[model samples]
Target: MTLDEDDRQRRLPAGRKAQLAAYVAETGQVTVSALAERFGVSIDTIRRDLDQLSADGVLVRTYGGAVSQSTLSRVDRAVDVRLKMEEREKEKIAVLAASLVEDGSIVMINGGTTTLAVARNLRNHRDLTVVTNSLLVPPALSPSAVRDVYVFGGAVRTLTLATIGPVSFRASGGSELDISCDLALIGVGAVSTAAGYTTSNLAEAAMMREMISRAARVAILADSSKFGRRLFAQVSELGGADYLVTDSTPPPDLLEALAENEVELITPDTREGAPEADQDPQ
Candidate 1:
């Protein structure tokens, strides 16, 4: 038997709970009964442990059991590679997301290959102010459409081309104030029904949360593949976003979860043009 399987044979309620974490990582997912059987614990005890693990971010609780928070591994890919990973899907999501931005709006966008696509799609938008932490986005935007491009200063990630730092800082004139935006276009590493929105970097998650707080409305640009997967740091719950702009429909459970959080899922329609908000997203 493997280490996790051996841990299952040992009966220590408190310690077993911790070992359950190992089992989760080893097995990826497990039912409550399975945990109880593996750990030789009571069903109620296993349930409590699952609850704790979920709270601790060690696992994502499902209806039946729990899954490892790292259900999907986050491999650091170069910007060029990421752009080619889900090119068409990113284009669809970007087009739909760009349509949500109106002219003369101040928009806040974070880093990612997907959000860069959205920046490209927003090329023709006039009198718009763009604030961002991505090194690659500003060049993708059109000069005529932009009033200004406010690039956030921070340490840049070479792999993903995103900056990690404080979302709010004192102005050059030494005035302290928070920058608010009409909308926030954020792209995250992974998303799940239970764990909500998450990313690989903790600093990015914190910065994204602060960015979300300052936005009047939030739009999360993620492809369908991101659904049901989670990364290392928790960004926010599903309710954190006002809209989820994705390439395809979410699964049934995820759809219900997004609905529960009042997040409007916006997926591309079968048409050749922009999709409307009234249509079903999932």
Candidate 2:
């Protein structure tokens, strides 16, 4: 180590284990050498601390050092299983997402449990034009005051109970008109600052992108667990959407990334300065 670093280490405070955990949480992921130098300690000491933190479920151990448990990457689950997980958080996100839709606006919804809840939350909206590929979504809004519900015709994927195919429709005697919507609410499989938005299925990702293309405003509905996770197919890059609706604030790095993308983050605790979307959802 450098002589200055050695001197600095000697002056650092004790109670390193707790400090180490907090450090990991703040930075998201850290490497052994970097942490050691930052804390003015040996690499071996940092490794030991990381191991103990991993065992305690305080952090997730990685190849070089450790990643914060809160931002550790994850994967998609079965549709039914996903429906049961994070029910309340999803509902809150759904409610917030629904706030982005105006009463008479045409809105496009991508398929997912959270997006399904978003559809249900729109029950009070009237004269709404809805377009979607989700088989389940149409039924959710059937009893609502929605004026027209257009289900995209495509190959049905039983796993997600959604359709996957072309984004356009064909009529025997005529070509289709250009489609547009005011808002597009999408639920993704995984979301990370590095990978942006993604889903496990390629076709699903493509459909989501197409839906976003046809909308004037885009809101991504995801619970906090979806943060920092990446999947096989990318849907859009960071800043690709207008807003991110979640149950809680994202990690610092992710929060900054979303801000950089101009993606307004909306959570129960973060609605302070946000537009009263329901009042002027233009």
Best-fitting candidate, scored by TM-score: 1
Over 162-248, each residue of candidate 2 has an lDDT whose tens digit, in order, gives 999867776776787678899999998778999999888888999999998988999888888879988899999878899988989
Per-candidate Cα RMSD to the true structure, in Å, reads 14.0, 13.2
Query: Worst ten-residue run, lDDT, model 2?
Result: 273-282
TM-score of structure candidate 1: 0.70
- Candidate 1 residue pairs that clash: 8-38
TM-score of each: 0.70, 0.69
- What stretches of model 1 exceed 4 Å from their correct place? 1-74, 270-282
Candidate 2 lDDT at 282 equals 13
How close to the true structure is residue 135 of candidate 2, measured as C-alpha lDDT?
90
